[model samples]
Target: MNFALGRYFPADFPLHRLDPRAKLLGSLLIMVGVLGARDLPALGLLALGLVATAALGRLPLSLVLGGLRPFFWLFLLTFLLNAYFTPGSPGPLGTSLEGTSQGAVLTTRLALMVLTASLLTLTTSPIDLTDGIERLLKPLRKVKVPAHEVAMMMVIALRFLPLLAEEAERIKKAQMARGVDFEGGILKRLKNMVPILVPLFMSAFRKADLLSLAMEARCYRGGEGRTSFSELRFGLGDGLALATSGLLALVGTIW
Candidate 1:
C-alpha cells in the first residue's frame, strides 16, 4: 500500500476547514497530553479523543491505522526493551510485571504521538502547514530564529516522505523482479536490503539536487520578503479546537 503518513486526504470536513495554525497547536497540545499520561485510563481517554477527531474529520479508519504501519518494528522494539530491562516484580517469560506495564504504556504513548501528527498532516496541506508554522514562530525572530527558513525545511522534509516511500517501493519491486529475496532470516533480510537502500539514497540525492536547481533557476531568495497568497485567520472553529485540545492536555497532565 502507498504511504499515507504525510499525504493529505482532501475532504470538506471540520478539521480540514480549521486554520492550520490551530491544527498545528492543537496537535502539539494533544502530544503534551500523550506525554503526560501516567496510566492506562489517561491513555485510553487520549486515544478515544484521537478516534473521535478522526471520525469528525471523516478520515477513513484504514488510512488512519495505515499511518502506524511504518512504525510497527519500532513499537515492538520499544516494548521488548522496556519489558526486559525495567526492574519490577517477576512475571511471565522472565519479564517483570511493572516492566510490562511500563512497556505497554510507553508504546501506547508513542502510538498516540504518531497518530496526532498523522492527523495534522492528513488534514492540512503542506502550504498551509508551512505558513502556520512560520507565523507561529514569528515571535522567535526577536531571538534571531530563522522562522521562515525553519518552517520551509520542516515542510520540505514532510513533503519528501511520500516521495521517498514511493521510490523505495519501486526499487523493492525491481529488485524482487531480479530474484532478490527480501524474505529470510533477520540477518539475511538486512543484508538483502542493501541493494534497495543504496539505490533509494542515490535517487533521493538526485531529487534533492534537482529541487535545488529548480529553486535557483527561479531566482529564489529566502523568506525575507515572502508573501502568502492565502492569509490564515483564526475563526470560531479554531478557537473551539484550541479550547478542546487545551482541556484535554490539562486533563491528561493533571489526572
Candidate 2:
C-alpha cells in the first residue's frame, strides 16, 4: 500500500470530488500537452499548473516528489544518452549544446508527466477509474468490444500492482538476510535475484489460482445489466477543469 502510483489518498478536496470522467478527460489533455510541448518554457508553465493542481488536491509535496523516485536512474540514463550521443554543435563541455538542451527538455517533460499522472491516481479511487473507463469504452461495444470485461481486467491489474511491489520488497529483505549480494555487478545482482524471482512467480500463480476459485465459488459473472452503487454526476467543478485543461492544451500547442 505504500507504493506511490496506484495508491489513492483520501481527501476532501475538489479534485477528489470531481467526477471521474472529467478527471480522466483533464488528465488526457494534460498528458497531450506535456507530450507536445516544444520548449522548456512551455514545460515549465505546465509543471507550475500541475503543482498548483496538486496543491488544490491537498497532496503533500513529499508524495509528489516521491512518486518519481523509481524512475530516477531511468531519467538520468536518458539524459546522458541524449546529451552525449545526439549530433549537434559541440559545447565547451564536449557535449553538443543542442543535445544537452534536448536531453534536459526531454527529462523534464517525462518527469512532469509522471508527477501529473500521480495526481490523478492519488485523487481517484480504483473503482471510480474502472467505472469511468467502462463508460468511456461503452461506445466501442458496437464493434464487439467487451468494455466491462476490459475495465474489470484493468482494475484487477491495478489492484495487484502494489501487492506485487510489496511482495518484491519482502523477498528482497529475505534474500538479503540470507547473505545474497544484490549490489554487486549487474550480472551478479541479476544472478542473485533468481532465488527471489522464482518464489515470487510461484506465489503469484498460487494467488491467481485462489482468486479464480473464489470468484467461481461466488458465481461471479462478467458485467451485464450491472448497476452502480455510486452515481457519477458532472458539476460546475468538472466544467472548470475541462476548460482549464483545454486552455493548457492550447498554450502548449502554440508554444
Which candidate number would show the highest lDDT if scored against the true structure?
A: 1
Q: What is the C-alpha RMSD of each candidate to the true structure, in Å?
A: 1.3, 2.0
Return the lDDT, model 1, position 168: 91
Q: Pick the candidate with the highest TM-score.
A: 1
Question: Residues 1-255, candidate 1, lDDT per residue (tens digit)?
Answer: 456678898989888999999999999999999999898889899998999999999999999998898889999999999999999999999999999999999999999998998899989988898999999999999999999999989988988998998899899999999999999899999999999999999999999999999989998797888898778899998999999998988898788
Tens-digit per-residue lDDT, 1-255, candidate 2: 246677788888888999888988898999899989999999988988898898999998888888788778889988888899999998866789999999999999889878776788889998898888898899999999999899888877766666777888898899889988889787898788898899889878887889889978988788877889888888998999988987997798679
For candidate 1, give the lDDT of residue 185.
98
Error of 1 at 32 (Å): 0.6
Any idea how many clashes model 2 has?
0
Q: In angstroms, how far off is 144's CA in candidate 2?
A: 1.1
